[model samples]
Target: MIGLSLNRVLAVLIKEFKQLTRDRVTYAMMLAIPVVQLTLFGYAINSDPRHLPTAVLAQEDSRYARSLVSALKNSDYFDFVAQARSPAELDEMIRRGEVQFAVTIPGDFSRRVARGDQAQLLVEADATDPSATSGAVAALAALPDQALAHDLTGALAMRGQAVKPFEVIVHRRYNPEAITAYNIVPGLLGIILSLTLVMMTALSVTRETERGTMETLLATPLEPLEVMAGKLAPYVMVGLVQTAIILAMAATLFHVPMSGGWLGLSAGIGLFITGSLALGFLISTVARSQLQAMQMSFFYILPSILLSGFMFPFRGMPAWAQWIGEAIPVTHFLRVVRGSLLKGQGIGDQWRELAALGAFVCVVTALAMARYRRTLD
Candidate 1:
């Protein structure tokens, strides 16, 4: 029987460390993932996001209107990005997600305020992501009391004394109830597709290489593109089935609305599935083994989950983080899914995100083919 020998234990420990150092990809992942999580959680993520994009439609250039706008900006929750020419334009901006909020002041705002009449300031918010808007919405509660304090001074000081002053009518558009499932269920399609498709495709391809079957397969007359197409075809079906199941559950169990038509949703899903499979193929080409492929896939998946606005608000991230998120296919896919399911946006409305997903597919497929060709040579 082997006793607990210190010398043998020390030898095994040193051997394990040597093997760990030899596996550079795994070693690097261990160190990098923690740092990535720390940096993302510490600096990039913000729950109470400030300076959200806001559109203004001031029908009158009155002092009271200006005061309200100033108060909104001063609250640090709203940043006026566009001056909407009409109500239609303002609604369009909110519909297209150009702005998180829209403020509309009536033409007779000052007249009514001066006369101590019930003046209304309309605030329309895109509440698709409830957490993103809750803080900003709460900030509005205090605005009516102080927003007009300066303007209501002098002869109109009595006007400010009214219990509510002017009414701030906030219209929470799209998911007025602020159901969390309404946001999460649609986004789950992207996150699940990313984790499963990428990992499965990468592992499958790399498994063939580890088992020495890749060389035999490469001996066939099939072209690189044809081989990749064959490898990815089954996974595409898997992705489709997964999407159908998730969406069905979302609608039936969660009662999440499917506002957009199937055409736009199908287009987005197809592009995303193709892109994710291609990305996995690219990773497989880069990885020397199945373990390496799995490790690399985790590297990609972590960022997708964190930066894609899946677990956090996308707009809450810093500019640099948002730029990085833009490059990830999952980010655009989330927009497409959420837009279609929640906002009922069509192809015309979500064209940018669809285009981004298309670009990802093209680029990744091209890179995968190139890398496979290099491996063949």
Candidate 2:
């Protein structure tokens, strides 16, 4: 055997470094990905979210009611945004994800408190994401004792010390069991589709260029839209099959409830699949090789998974992160899937999310067409 040569090994090491530095996409990925992960995980993510939007339905305008609301605000958890007029309105507000909590104070609240009778304060929490509401709900335990401290001073001091002031009845709506699977299973559908469809389409198109089959495509008379649609059509079926498989397992294995809204569910899945494929096509146009395409896909996929409320609470993120998450199609798709399967929300109820997904499809398709060059430049 030949003796080992350190000089020859050093020359190869320098050459490999030169090659690594030349691939800007891979080089940027190595640097950019770690910084993004650190920034998001360190600053953007929060497990104990505060200032959650809460809706109040106050039927009595009494000092005690005011004190209770003040105490809730002091806790820094409930931010009263809307005043629901009725119980039906309160239910609708939480169902549509307008508020994290619904506070309903009965008309007889002050009267019952005065008589030392059993006065109840109802707090309905949107428990779709248990981690988001768990802290706020736990904080409510202390509210009953101290919420009306100043009110029960002179004549009502006995009421405060002898017995509890009033009961804080917390009704955990949708996923009342606080099952993590209920949230995760529906969200997986979006994550799975985004990861697979985007990577697959990007790699498929870039592979043609790498293998020299793109020249044959360049000689054809196909328009950019035609080429994109044709290339993505089969992948749409693949995405749908993946969706069906995940959903079936979610139902049978996890026993995740499919409340209703099949039409909305189907619409969301179709739009997301189309958008993901179009995004992949856009990536293919920018990437020079399959490796670049893969790197770019991970660049998009990591943020989508992190910021789209898949791995963390959407509301738990900072304002900037939430804004970025809104732009990602996965965020809207997650809402659509969760709303339809968990909340039984109809198309009318979740039109905004569907509109966002539809807009993503249109914008990405346009960008893909604009980026595509028939000359293979």
Candidate 3:
């Protein structure tokens, strides 16, 4: 008789099923997150970035120089965004990441080539994100042959090779090896922490309300600051643990070098975690239920994924998009993580990002404290 109760079990199952149906946000997340993540990750995320903004500094007004410029544009890598008046202007463009490449055709390039003299072509690329620049740089090697095909005829027929003989000197700075993992692995830290820490803290206050504990907390002497600290302090440790795991795996598996000081990186990570916790707390204040908290968290999460330079080069996006990206916390964090991890940037070099994250934490904390209600009434 005590072995099993079929009716009771069915009744409990039915009750649970009904409860599941009422949580519409949870139900929708179960179905929507996969489709949305798959769609965005599969389609929007691109490794081999294209249509890069480029500036041309064509010193010689020869047909061959013009052809080379045209060939570069036709390559689909460079978009020919501007014409540089001088090398300094071109350098400025590349420095600001306003242009990925600057094609500098030296004076008398065609004349030098027509006379079979070795001509040097300078293709300066913003190699900060090596993957973005490498593809375009490789295409430059064949430019001399393609651009001078028309010139390598008639009187140049006998010396066809000489008519278009040019050397492409590609300048790949920052990441010289063009390692994809170097660019990708460090960014994973921001993304994973955002997903976990934000969502976890987003649920904390909401869970208290759903379980009838919010009123109990209101009855106690605890202030909102105390509650916020209690909720976020443990998660700070959790974030540190997550950081360690990600960094360890990145180093052991992908061989990502940690050239910067750990103290600097740790400070950045701690600040980022604090900021994420503050954001989550702010969400908890707005959401009426735990499910609403989760929904609100995703509202922030998706944008962070798209605009944070994790999947694509940050500078590759348009000016308007870059402005939007700057508003995102993850964007600044990505800069710090990548700079310290790959470029060996010291604390001084990373002060800008650290300062931005610190400011962000302060802002979010103020907003969270302002939004947090002391009572369920």
Candidate 4:
């Protein structure tokens, strides 16, 4: 009896292995995803921000200005890359994406300090990306005092005068703390939703088609819209469950705070899931088989991962890359999630992103319904 039972179990295991090995795509995914995910996350995910390109616009060639520039160069965080003769040159460098920050020292910087009058150092930072900007600002803040002290001691030795009345105040408005998690977690929400919903819907739809059940459903009295709605309703519920799980994990495990109201977060998640599921339905309509559906889903997932603000700050990317990101629904959803959760912004602040998501849902839903009807016919 024991020998017969063991033989039966071995036969079942062998059959299951054969079935799994038959699908080349699934076999590759099973082995490749872990390695790919590990490598991508290991090198690309950097919580410590550095190497911010910085420019100096010094009108004064005095000891104080030169000293400040030297101090900036010595710091690891700021890369002293360019020297701008005028504000226009500095602005041009920043706009042209050559430099992330610029510092200007007035012509009378040394003269004012020697005479006991107040000397001000002007610092300009690119506020396009809040995370990079904060790092640059913090590095700049620590430099001026050290530079001024060196300048003061040298000036006293040369002209026999005391060093006083020098001030360096930092003006970092957008993101003061340079909190990496605050910037990334919000973007991650969009990515998590997209991956879960798209994969789930794609597999579910393809499974029905593969099993020859979709044809039976089409033969029923239900319209395409009704069928699509029915197919999506269950996943929408699953999306909500997944959203809650993710939110809890983010909060408890990662210490990611949610500053927005629960209702607003729920609404945003619903819209995002609607858009993602619609996209999945569109993918299902075009794909001929389950393997094809997963392949198409992967094509979508790769670009979204790279181009979205989740991996890298959108402003840091070149203009063409930024334009590509704008077309993705995940990009807009990230903006909404980040603004609400990290910035403690309300619906009014995120209306533009919300509108973009609404537009995505409308467009994708229309396409899915049209394609679904054709499939039924």
Pick the TM-score winner: 2
Task: Give candidate 4's whole-model lDDT.
Answer: 0.71
Each candidate: what lDDT? 0.91, 0.92, 0.82, 0.71
Give the per-residue lDDT of model 1 (tens digit) for 106-193. Answer: 9989888887788899999998889899999999999989898877777688747746568899988999999999998898999999
User: Who wins the lDDT comparison?
Assistant: 2
On residues 134-229, what C-alpha lDDT tens digit does candidate 4 reach at each position?
655666656644666655655454443333346665544234455566566666778877887897787766787889898887777878788788
RMSD of candidates 1 onward, in order = 1.5, 1.2, 4.6, 7.2
Tens digits of per-residue lDDT for model 3, 87-165 = 9888766754467788889998888787778888988876657766777887887887777776677777567654557
Model 4 regions more than 4 Å off = 1-131, 138-179, 261-264, 374-377
Which 10-residue window of candidate 4 scores lowest in summed lDDT? 156-165
In terms of lDDT, model 3 sits at: 0.82
If scored against the real structure, what TM-score would every candidate get? 0.97, 0.98, 0.75, 0.63
From the highest lDDT down, the ranking of the candidates is 2, 1, 3, 4
* Angstrom error at residue 272, model 1: 0.3
Runs off by more than 4 Å, candidate 1: 374-377
lDDT of 2 at 301: 95
Off-target runs (Cα >4 Å) in candidate 3 are: 1-16, 38-43, 56-63, 82-96, 127-130, 150-153, 157-164, 237-271, 287-307, 312-327, 344-363
Q: What is the lDDT of residue 108 in candidate 1?
A: 88
